[model samples]
Target: MRLALATAVVLSLFTSPTMAEPTVKLHAAGSLKAAMSDIADLYEKTHGVTVARAFGPSGLLRERIEGGEAAEVYASANMKHPTTLATAGKAGPVALFARNRLCALAQADLAVETETLLATLLDPQVRVGTSTPKADPAGDYAFQVFDKAEAFSSGATEALKAKAFQLTGGKDSAKAPEGRNPYGWVMESDKADLFLTYCTNAVLAQRDVPELKIVALPEALSVGANYGLTVVNDAPQAAWQLAVFILSPAGQEILASYGFTAAGAL
Candidate 1:
């Protein structure tokens, strides 16, 4: 009778739910939402561990983590942010997980051409929307593209910069109007003639609003964004698992389907 009771107790301890993997806290960049969400879902289904996510501009997310916010994983839109964290001893080594490019998103009727993209942006009647620089890598990339515009016309860089409105994609952007896609809502509301954002985001917007057009930037005027990720220094073991999964072949497939290039491809 005593042996049987001890055997039952040992079995219960082995089967306890507490032995399962712990939930992972994930702080990811806004541009990676769809891909990361899909990966998290898949991971949860197979691993029995939840991934709690908080998405925002990479720079702001970094700021939060640096300001004592707790998260196990940090995925950034650019290499600099994650590298910064690792250098400060907050995270592990950074890895380039994905890549994207800057593009212009506009309503169907807007006439934005790759050949005259800078000229179109400079037109007095045209209003442009851009993310906030220093706070978001998308905005920083947009400014880099603007710098490339200088070859076509002197002062074109500053002129385009001055005219561009910091409408959305900022750390403090207004809650997207209820029931509306933030990108589409801003464009439909006439906030700007065109929005400069990631090619992946433009792809998503056009999928939701078929009438929206995605205008590719001229190759010379385009800037590629490198995405980086790292596990926080004190992260749970599951966090390291997730970081590895994102760099795995299956993870790269999901990101590719969402319009991002694998970091290895770039």
Candidate 2:
């Protein structure tokens, strides 16, 4: 009896009563930073699972995943990247998680409004800033705006595309100073007189630089963004749970507070 009890104690010492919770690895678009941080915190508190997150341009993040980086979940600023992953069998089905629209961030003294927004962007004297196309969805959306400009005037697309400065979202783009919004920092540094970016990003930029103005794109030029979420193939169960929670009402509320149109609402 004494020998048996000692053996039992040894086995107990090597085994845990409950399995350790898994950590979920999430790669998401930079635009989702503020919202996803809150969601991750809430998920940790409620589910007892830690989340490791990486944020950047959605297209770049997708490229990292395609290149064999270990990401259990992916959230993108547009459906294209995540859908591409899903098509490649790298991830599960894509889901629309959020929506956003474009707006122009202008210098405090710049004269811009919905009525003259196109003219302002076309003016030879104005310096237009944009994210790098194909590497960032914001830049793609800006170009889409330029495409729509063609309906108003011929040769508008080429002219706007030629003058636009690709200042951010590329691999070598300058990093903003610590604790500074990239958009605000760029404007403060006089990188451009009018920068086209997501409306939500514009809001954050304005918060950082109160003097900056956020001008809404005219109805004719407005372009909407669709955010996508997916669970990577072979990801642990915790990843699926986290993805579900992001689509949950509670998660949607957090995103909505940050100016995103929640998936359910759309």
Candidate 3:
């Protein structure tokens, strides 16, 4: 009877379901998708923990976190969003993980260069595209470029802002077909002649549309972007570990390969 009872107990133990592995939820900017996905894969392989990732506009992600969405870590295109969360006690201290810069993605026929970027953008017939400001940091950076343009040519800022189309990264923005780059799709669809976005994004867009031209912003109108990262308050230790890995040399190397200026280099 004792032997039979012992066998039954062992059998039940073998049939019982094991506890689920720990998961870290990460909310990050859309621009970080490719690099972050790679980083997550490496971390999961090394630490044996699952990383659930969600990517979109940084500002929108911040709003979601603010509205009580569950996120272990938040990565933003600008420090302002994560810093705001830290200020509100929703997240931990903000840290700079990566850096980027603004560039112009222009249609093939448009004759634009760094020197003539301002004139090309301000041209009455040209249709300029930008991300939605306040909903996406890309738009804020584009507008910052416009602000710098004001110094070179009076009213340049107003002219550029008024004519720019808020195409992507907005609540009502048109959705790109699956497997399509949003910026490339928008430009290819004749939505805009020129679009201002992050240099990394512009590179991706160019990859999507081989003929598309990426024009560097002139020195006078240049805008540098700083990406911030933070873990939500009370998150598991694994979340902090993930954040640390993102700032580590291995992760920075991955980001740099994607055209981002790593935090260490920045």
Candidate 4:
């Protein structure tokens, strides 16, 4: 069944496409699922190539490349991470794709605003969850939130740590001390009061979970996170084709519709 499912989903690649396209495998950031998938389908239709995406934390994906997991194109949650991957010889020249901000979000049924969300995370009543800094770019971005809170001063790290019951989050947290993690740890949970993540994640989450409320992040505390794309070692031609398509105007338009901010535009 899994094989059949895979074949059907990737059926476009096996058949000869009009654009002389090849099948490309893409390893992308977890936060990019919605935007990337939307662009991928359009890219396949226009370019006659199929792009298969494997989404996960950027840090771990970089590690996968370092450990020799073969890939073609890599899209990271933050350019810094893909830049780091390039530096470490795991990737190639990366181009900026889109930018997002760190948003403190919760269920609309609650009354947590931006200020209240941050305060609540620090309060004993809130048990915040964030992706692990070592494994996910969201974790690093989350830490940056605290970094901004302190103006990069002392005690910021510890204070951020204290705002949570656990530092580890996402699928990899099974390897962590928490051992059990929720599927969707919204900021306003029945048991907790605050959660932190990127606005990109919220955009994707809204597709299925419409009750999510967005907390307005203060300009002083907010950060613009960039998504980056790069070619990997010895990847197929289809990868390059998809990469070009993503950089094209059509692809950019699709991303913009999903709240992506182009770096060069600013």
Measured by lDDT, the strongest candidate is 2
lDDT of 3 by residue, 1-266 (tens): 22332243344345434443489899999999989999999999998999999999999999999999999889999999999998998877788889999999999999988889888898999999999999999999999988898898899989999999999998788999999999999999999999999999999999999999999998888899999988787676677777877887888999999999998722
Per-residue alpha-carbon lDDT of candidate 4 for residues 159-258, written as tens digits (9 for 90 to 100)? 8766653333454454312312232343323433445677766655444456666676777778778788777755555675677667667777777877
Of the two candidates 2 and 3, the one with more favorable lDDT, higher being better, is 2
Clashing pairs in 1: none
Decide which is better by TM-score, 1 or 4: 1
Tens digit per residue, CA lDDT, model 1, 1-266: 22332243344344444444578899998889889999899888878889999988899999999999998889999989988998899877787889999999987788878887777888878898988887889999998988998998899898999999987767678657655566777777778888899999888777767788889999889899999888777665677667767877778888998999986421
lDDT of 2 at 23: 88
lDDT of 2 by residue, 1-266 (tens): 22332243344335433343468899999989989999999998999999999999988999999999999889999999998998898877788889999999999999998899999989999999999899999999999999999999899999999999999998989989989999999999999999999999999999999999999998889999999888787776667677878887888999999999987832
Which has the higher TM-score value, candidate number 3 or candidate number 4? 3
For model 1, what is the error of residue 212's alpha carbon versus the real structure, in angstroms, after optimal superposition?
1.2
Distance (Å) between predicted and true CA of 224, model 4? 1.6
TM-score of 2: 0.92
Per-candidate alpha-carbon RMSD to the true structure: 8.9, 9.7, 10.5, 8.2
Residue 97 of model 1, lDDT score: 88
lDDT on C-alpha atoms for all candidate structures: 0.82, 0.88, 0.88, 0.66
Residue pairs clashing in model 2 are: none
Could you tell me the lDDT of residue 242 within candidate 3?
78
TM-score of 4: 0.79
**Per-model TM against the reference:** 0.90, 0.92, 0.91, 0.79
Query: Candidate 1: where are CA atoms >4 Å away?
Result: 1-20, 264-266
| TM-score, prediction 3 | 0.91
